[model samples]
Target: MARSLKNPKKRKNKGSKKGGGASSSSIPSLPTKVWQPGVDKLEEGEELQCDPSAYNSLHAFHIGWPCLSFDILHDQLGLIRTGFPQTVYCIAGTQAEKAPWNYIGVFKLSKISGKRRDLVPKRHDDDGDGDDDMDSESSSDDEEEGGEGESQPPVLQLHKVAHEGGVNRIRAMAQNPHICASWADTGRVQIWDLSADLNALAESEADVSTGGSTLLSRAPLIKFGGHKDEGYALDWSPLVSGRLLSGDCKNCIYLWEPSSSATWNVDPSPFIGHTASVEDLQWSPTEPDVFASCSVDWTIAIWDARRGKSPAAVIKAHKADVNVISWNRLASCMIASGSDDGTFSIHDLRQLQGDSRVAHFEYHKLPITSIEWSPHEPSTLAVSSADNQLTIWDLSLEKDEEEEAEFKAQIKEKVDVPEDLPPQLLFVHQGQKDLKELHWHGQIPGMLMSTAADGFNILMPSNIENTLPSENS
Candidate 1:
């Protein structure tokens, strides 16, 4: 299903191919053209173009400070939500210049509703002007009735809590959204119980009270300064309640077991594998005992919790530092790794001893910052880069000459797509600077949220071919 935008605001692109220009009689007119960010340099008088029709819904908002990381919280809302106007919750960590000025932010975004463009566009040659007019009137009536709140602008409700230092990374427990863990730049990891704050946000229908906005400095549930140095790697096991893994710059990973409701038992002995700093961690979706980690040493290691500290297997994954990784929830054997170089790869764990890599792409010009597989789609994933672009890809898509030719003919008058562009590439989202992290909404199939140096973007692209299962199935 394709979605549409309602009351999309016009935006100027910094550098995009000119859709209108003078041409010789011998040259054909290509009214629209696809522009690659790093590959295409802007010509004089050329400005970037944002096609409003390409979005189903797009909203940009900012907190006071830039957040380097954030997690899309799983809400009490129904697990599968296809209807709109929609609402979402998230928790983010700040990267403030002064450590004392930093705080953790919890946000609730609501009234996200929009009309989607047609999934299969109407033929240009169709003689259906009367039918189109009738359809437009029907759509307008539907929007007026169902989306009246949308016209008032989306609402943002925020709750903040004081932290001792800037958060290097943060993650919420999958089993409990109110319980969160944050790695601070001060070389300490703190666990926070946000049940009270969450309840307050949920009960209030109006703007949150900022009178007590800076939540008083309440001591954390547990504070650990076990690691020799601070690091960015963190994850909570989805299959096991309260299980956690935190890696450090010193090349050691620690496992935390739930000892009680508020306290965790951290083992003194660390899971040592990567010779260099561990950059990221992900627990296996199907196997609670299995997990994966990537490091600056350019290796991806698979570990089994019961087998002591040694990794079960290791694969030399990349040339540069392996910065991030995502384990596919739908396909248990598939895992993806992104590197300090722009390249990212898909590896099949079943073939770890042999040639495990299923595919590799060197598309982004800058280092890959964050990557994750879509919760709803097995073959789909999203990547954020230092180059300031968020890209979505479908691994299942393959190049077809006949189909490409037909598509080119159909939209050649509308867009001049580059022949060299990868067939699997689905969408390119820009406007954010120094994109740090992105996550797909667990309850909403096609929705995405990203945080960067500038702020945050909540978006739903119009053209993704989303497939949902039947209720009976």
Candidate 2:
């Protein structure tokens, strides 16, 4: 559902007695300041406030259980979508309390619309006109009462299939989204065809009652229990329709070669690399046989499917456990890795033997859970951390003294911002608790979806300049 962000009021810090016994009445109220997520330390009673004007659109939804992983499905919706009231399709795996209670969730979110930032300036203050603010509020109230914006709340249609265990990780093939592979905590990998459920949800009059408890548990098209231990790392090759890779806690990686539409040949020999548990895997966007993997051993390895088990090259990536990695499709040479220490780094594959690190960020204070490069923008990427924040960054952004000074001067009267924050930090998203994973919509520019312990959030920040192209262009 669409959420409303209340206007933030200035918080007054009342003065207390000091060595000189200063009177509280003599202290003046401090200037209102903007709260920085990672930089600022909140006081005992302080609370974080969200500014609605900072976002182009924002909506939230919840499934019955917490999803440890989710993938945004490539849909029939036209690519390069620049219009409002967009629709999205996604598939996720649940982390339910009991094994049998868990299920795979296939859902759709629709009618996501909100006021464009350019269409409406800050609504809290109307250029020192109190009457104007009152009029704006009245008009907004009338619109809501007249069954305009709120009449049709963002629709959430979901279907589920019972599974034997909690999902460790899940991914859908880029070439065919209905075909998905899932890693179960029970130490098994299973492939499923979600065409039936996906088609049911796509109908205009989908019977919500036909899903959930009403649907019988369906068997996987193919299930492999070759791994000795359970795993979390899994990915389907973007180049091949059904080719897959799965890695386990024992540092073993198995390759799955598709034999037919519903079956796969699981190679007995496992990939040899990474001494510790493989935490994540990413298929190379440009190469047909190459892929990347990060491990608890603090390393990232590049491998070829046909070149035996040994990695083609391995790079020492982080100080702590490397939790996740993302290969940029727009810039195939660039790869991003996130670590348990909350730091994430970007690397160029062309210069791997030497100091290949291009950019490293330590802004997040907890383990980095997920990271991904934008499919639409080569330089843009998103990172999610256990600190309950999702951050967007642009590698192309750089510090400019003159531009910084001009920007400070413009907002100085309205906002007091810190000077130490990184200039490349484009947007900081908060409110989600225990963020597990995030993915950018492949067809829609700047659209992002995230799954957390509490629920899911779909947001498009207004500050991302020129994300939507003009009609003529």
CA-lDDT, candidates in order: 0.79, 0.77
Candidate 2 residue 36 Cα shift, in angstroms, is 3.8
- In candidate 2, which residue ranges exceed 4 Å CA deviation? 1-32, 37-41, 119-152, 205-215, 467-473
Question: In angstroms, how far off is 275's CA in candidate 1?
Answer: 0.8
Report model 1's TM-score to 2 decimal places: 0.88
Best lDDT goes to which candidate? 1
Q: Write the per-residue lDDT of candidate 2 for residues 1-473, one digit (tens) a residue.
A: 00111111111111110011001111135434655555667676655555555665677676667778889999987767756667788888877766777889887877666544433334555376443542243445223222365424467778887877888888998888998999998999999999998897788544343124343488899999999999989999888889899999899999999999889999999997899999899899889899999999999999988899999999999999999999999999999999999999999999987977989998898899999998888999999988878889998989999999976876665567777878889888887766789999887777788877666778777666555563322
Error of 1 at 24 (Å): 22
Lowest lDDT block of 10, candidate 2 = 14-23
